[model samples]
Target: MSIIKKLASQTAIYGLSSIFGRFLNYLLVPLYTYHFSAAEYGVVSEFYAYAGFFAVLLVFGFETGYFRFRDKNDPQRDSAYSTALWFVLGANLVFLLLIRLVRTPLSEALHYAHHPEYVEWFAIILGLDAIASIPFARLRAENKAFRFAGIKILEILVTVGLSLFFIAYCPPLYAKNEQVWFAPIYDPGIGLGYVFIANLAASGVKFVLLTPQLKGLIWGFDRVLFRKMVGYSLPMVVIGFAGIVNEMLDRALLKYLLPHDPLMNMRMLGIYSACYKLSILMSLFIQAFRYAAEPFFFAYADKSDARRVYADVMKYFVIFCMAIFLLVTLYIDFFQYFIGREFRAGLGVTPILLLANLFLGIYVNLSIWYKLTDRTLMGAFVSLGGALITIGLNLWWIPHYGYVGSAWATLACYAAMAVVSYLLGRRYYPVAYDLKRIAFYIAFGLGLYFAREPLLTYGYRSWQAGTLLMGSYLLSAALFEFRGLFHFRKKLPAGDSGKSLGPGRK
Candidate 1:
């Protein structure tokens, strides 16, 4: 219970950036959906999807490798940080140069020869972000959560400010009076491209914000350590690539797999992506928790009671995810308004995707077994299996059901991976998780969600039903974990043994 409190505290600090900062970023979704056509927004979503894959390639998993080797294996290690930083820096440099050469050909292949600037801009943005990865990871490694949250918030502000300048403020001013003071930054022809440009500008600012990380740091590269670290972390790249497949492949694949024309296909993709953002609350929590949990888990791995702590964390994680699932799905009528009217038709996929993200978070937590045991290749295999499921299902289903099929495919992939990871993890490194209780929590929350629509017309209101469902569920959880929640201790008679019984696990 104490350790869980610590984890929750850290997650809250990290959430300032992940949830709050991204909430500010989420404002852009409505802005984009309202201003640009669905086809235009889809292009932005598709390019960012490709960026997700490239970002993984750029890091090659050195961030986790740094955490494992420097912090856990050899706490006194001095050069691991510099070694990882320089290696990724050089890799990103090479990537930037390579992209410069193929930018034209790549643009033409993507039917964007006329706007190769998009490809050129994103390559630089991705490369710069890749180089910044280690500095950012260093903050996490050192438990510098506030610094991290601050820099991330600043980055989001840059993005939002630039986007508004170009998309909202500058356009009308430029049209009515081209000589206005801020008119030069606006270009109506750019359309959805401002979104990418805003991203590029903000990414550049992230480097500047993190410049202080370079001080008091060793830049000297250790060839031997670099080689060893890469050897260990290389398999993580596969895991990361597969993870991206589960996340972004549907958007990329929908273009060619669907029978519709390119424009119409993009429009449908845009609709799905917009609605997908509506389900991001669960993912937001997972991201925040991951940032805090990964370092905490690794740092505490050597403790004798670490497995018990991990088990408790898992139970609490599922409980919170289920709560979030109900929170969003129960009030989805309002969330769908975050997207344009055309996009709201796909709101049915939100709950499916939300559950999928919950499973993904579980898989992430389970992945620590492989990370701790250094059996990272097993993690790679699990992710690869999930990737295959993602690819096969998206290919077969997209033609028939479009993006809705993709949503269900994501849920299936994550759920399968979670089960496989748990089974394999227990075989190799058993943790006595209270699976029955956790399963009941998930099932109960889902039952409440499913019961919402049916009761809507039977004199039940959403808020009223939501309050009843969530309130009762919380009370049930409190009673189930009363020992921890209430911290009850037995009363002893005066002068009697002077010892009191503490709370017991139910």
Candidate 2:
């Protein structure tokens, strides 16, 4: 099969889990938004932002290391795996111990000293998830895409099911029969804490399900292999850390930089976070694309025409992402219903964030230049630059503008990285990406978007207005650039006909 076809198949399978899993989890947005106040949901948002940061640390770039080294034609693949496993295991153990030892200080730092249990539980959860990551990467490398997708879907289903039962169903049952099983442990006042417990339970179940992958693996540690993998993966650690900080630093900083009330600040964050989830469709596509593209890129890196293929891939990637952005923004009046009424106030940021995510996806496509060339340190530098820009913008803007500042900070950070990478990649590796044509498409889409508001003032229904705008954009592409829309394959003439047409094959 062609590489593109193979990638599409794998992406479909992986996206099944991601799309459906996200949709299922998406249900929780309404549940949480309805049940908890914006402030309460903000706690959930803030904590998970920390989770994203800590997760990058716990995995320590071993996932990328596994991918980089697993293809080596050596007998030490198992040794590499074991070495990475042991390194994370040791680090996680030490991390957990340290957190436990300083639980008081940690709790105080988070201003949740009364809830040190939250810290303790979160620490254990992070540790388990970190250790599980290497094996997960192994699954991806081994092309066990089906198993990987299934486990992921199963985990999401279990988590969603438990959360619904606890938050939506359990309260009513307990209210009617106070003497029912485990009544003492159930507290409706705990609010967002139930979300955490459900996550812990689901994560534990995934660890159990992944035991088959763990079984029968040799467990011997190799110091030499460990050193090599660390050397290779350390740059990726910096890259991952900086990349996540660029994405999440605003959320972490907003609590302190914004106004005084913890509850109000959290509420604003929650509103922003919920509205941000609307962009998950684009994020999900990029994620599935990356999962397929990474290994495919490495495998094809030595091919003579690889640069052309990369250029084609980027063109299509930008096309599809822009298409998604248009769809979301054009129909946002309807999409706003995904969150509760309180969150609708933050809907203004959704379009801005969606565009930022599109830029981020483009940046990921451009990043292949560095990865395939073994100039991975370039990625670290690019991400660090973006992170620094994000921090600076948030600090400068958040005090004055609050959540709007965070939104602009995110947009600026991603736009900077995408443009910077494209310029640098052209100098270093030089893929002839259709930048002029892509920019035209973006400009046309934006024009269509801005024009829609004025057109809607003429008494069109919301859907009618969106449909008109989307159709206009499509029609514009078809008319002005229809040749680019067509896919043609050249064919050879039949035996005798080939001879007749040999000199002038048209």
Candidate 3:
């Protein structure tokens, strides 16, 4: 198969987990928003925002580091895996210990002193998740996409199932009988803590399920390779921490910056975060693609047409992302129902956030250059710049215009970051990206999004306008830009019309 075809197939496989699993998890948004007040949901949102920061720190760029080094020591690829695994494991244990030492004070500082267990739950969740990172990366590197997807699906199933049982089922059961069979497990006062507990359980189960991947592992560490991996991955610490800052600092800053009661501030943030799920479709695709693309890019780096494959991946990624943008934005009236009505007030930010996510995805694609060229320091600089933009603007905008300002800040930060990454990538490890087509798709997608209101003015239902616009956009894209991919050749004996570039399989 062609590299693009392989990428598409693998993305689909990973999507079975990343995309579908997230979709299943998406059900939790409704459950949470419905079960908890916007303010309560805000507390949940804030902790997860903090979780994003720690998650990045706990893994400390080892996922990408493992990818970069795996091929270097091909004779013992497991050396890279084992070293990366041990490095993250040690870091997580220390980090969790430190959290244990300060859990109460840390919880108080975050204004969650009433529920310090949040600290303990997330500490364990982050540690287990960080340790699971290498094995998941190994699955991708080994092209075990199906197995990866399966475990991922199972994880989400357990998470979502338990969340529903706790938040929805147990309460009614207890109401009927406080002496119910699961009484010990159910606590109504704990409220949103169940969300964290469910997530913690799911993450722990995933870690256990990955025990097979951990077996037969050598315990000895290579000091030289360890230093090299650290040298390569240390910069990722900045890049990742800063990237999370860009992605999540708004929610964090909003809690402190909003001129309202603590609960009110959380309400505002909850609203922002809930509506932000409107862009979850794009978010899901980016995740699935990232899961597959990182290892794919590393593995294909030495290909005769590596640059060409990278370029194709970039163009196609934009095409699909743009398509998602139009589809989601046009139909957001329905997606708005994913959150409660109080949160839907922030739906105006959805389009902007969707575009921001699009740019972020492009930034991730452009990032392959730095990863491949071992220019992680440059990547760190770029992410630091983006994080500064995110912070400065949130500090400036939240007080003046609320979460809308944060939304615009997100877009501006990512747009600036994408341009900066592209420019630096060209200078360092250039790929001839199709800028004109990318610009056209984005412009066209935005144009269609802006037209949604006008179409709705004609009294068509939101879904009707959405479907009509989506169809028109797809048909137009096909006629003008995607027609060539439509042409087909007679099947060869082996089914691939393109020249077989490797050893015969049959």
In model 1, the Cα lDDT at residue 326 comes to 86
> Please, what is the TM-score per model?
0.94, 0.92, 0.94
lDDT of 2 by residue, 410-455 (tens): 9899999999998888777777777887888788778877877887
Arrange candidates, best lDDT first. 3, 1, 2
Score residue 85 of candidate 1 by CA lDDT. Answer: 79
Q: Compose the digit string of candidate 3's lDDT tens values, residues 1-506.
A: 38889998999888767878898899999999988899989988888899999999899888888888775546244688888888888889999999999999999988778889999999999999999988998888888998899899899999999999999999988889899999887888887889999999999889889999885257456778888999999899999999899999999899899888887888999999998888998998999899888888888877766776687789889989999998778877678888887888899899899999999999999998788888899899999999999999999999999999999999999999999998887777777787898888888878887788898898978888888889887888788654545442232344343233332111
> Candidate 1: lDDT of 284?
90
* Candidate 3 or 2, higher TM-score: 3
Clashing pairs in 3: none
Could you give candidate 1's per-residue lDDT for residues 1-506 as a string of tens digits? 57789899999999767888999899999999999888888888899899999999999999888887774445344588878878888889999999999999999999888899899899999998988888888898878899999989989999999998889988887888878886566667886678889989999999998888765256578889888898889999999999999999999998788789998999988999998998788989999999999989888776666787788799999988988898888877678779888778788889999999999999988887788888889899999999999999999899999999999999999999999999988777677778998899999988888788777878788778777777877888778787654542244234442112211121
Q: Rate the local accuracy (lDDT) of all candidates.
A: 0.86, 0.80, 0.86
- List where candidate 3 sits over 4 angstroms from the true fold: 71-77, 484-506
Q: Candidate 3 — number of clashing residue pairs?
A: 0
Q: Report clashes for each candidate as comma-separated counts.
A: 0, 0, 0
Which portions of model 2 miss their true places by more than 4 Å?
72-77, 181-185, 216-219, 474-482, 485-506
